[model samples]
Target: MRDHTEFDSFAAFCDQSPWAFDDVADVRDVSRARLDEYVAGRTDFETWEEMKTRAAEEEIIDQIVS
Candidate 1:
């Protein structure tokens, strides 16, 4: 896994990019909400596959929009 510093740097880079923030907020919000649901035992995906799939789809959409 990446260290916090590396993640921070990557986030900084994203913040600087024109492709960031605008759609990221919505995507992140949805992802967080879904994650919270899972954490609250409302779902049953022992792994992160579902979350990852949603994130990947969102990312693709973001890329297309950008």
Candidate 2:
């Protein structure tokens, strides 16, 4: 969406713990730099690999609904 408030709210939703989703709205409205900062500094993950590992370790990937 073009609205900043909508993008912010959506990004925050995506950052929730124990995330599980097969698809979401394209977030290109949010810059990659901002998204990376959110993941690295705000979230538990320092990198995408770490997020994947953690998800797999917790066995939530397959449990996620498509």
Candidate 3:
């Protein structure tokens, strides 16, 4: 497992990336056109699959730690 510092860095990465917060209600409510902008590299990730994979990994790691 990564140390707290690594986790903190990952958290910061998420904070700065639009794809990292897609589950937020306001983010989900955006129009398809707006979503396309983010998915097309307005943020760190280029596609929903990449973001989803990262989110799922985060969830799995959280479960293991908890």
Candidate 2, run of 10 with poorest lDDT: 1-10
> What would the per-residue lDDT of candidate 1 be over residues 21-56, giving only the tens digit for each residue?
555354454455544554234223333356355557
- For residues 1-66, could you state the per-residue lDDT of candidate 3 as single tens digits? 133123345445346555556445545665666565555553456555566577789889889999
Winner on TM-score (2 vs 3): 3
> Candidates' TM-scores?
0.32, 0.36, 0.41
How does candidate 2 fare on TM-score?
Answer: 0.36
Error of 2 at 28 (Å): 11
Worst 10 residues of 3 by lDDT: 1-10
Report each candidate's C-alpha RMSD, comma-separated, in the order given: 14.1, 10.3, 6.4
For candidate 1, the 10 contiguous residues with the lowest summed lDDT are: 1-10
Task: Using lDDT, rank the candidates from best to worst.
Answer: 3, 2, 1
Clashing pairs in 2: none
List per-prediction Cα lDDT, in the order shown: 0.45, 0.49, 0.54
Which candidate should be chosen as best, given lDDT against the real structure? 3
For candidate 3, the per-residue lDDT at 54 reads 71
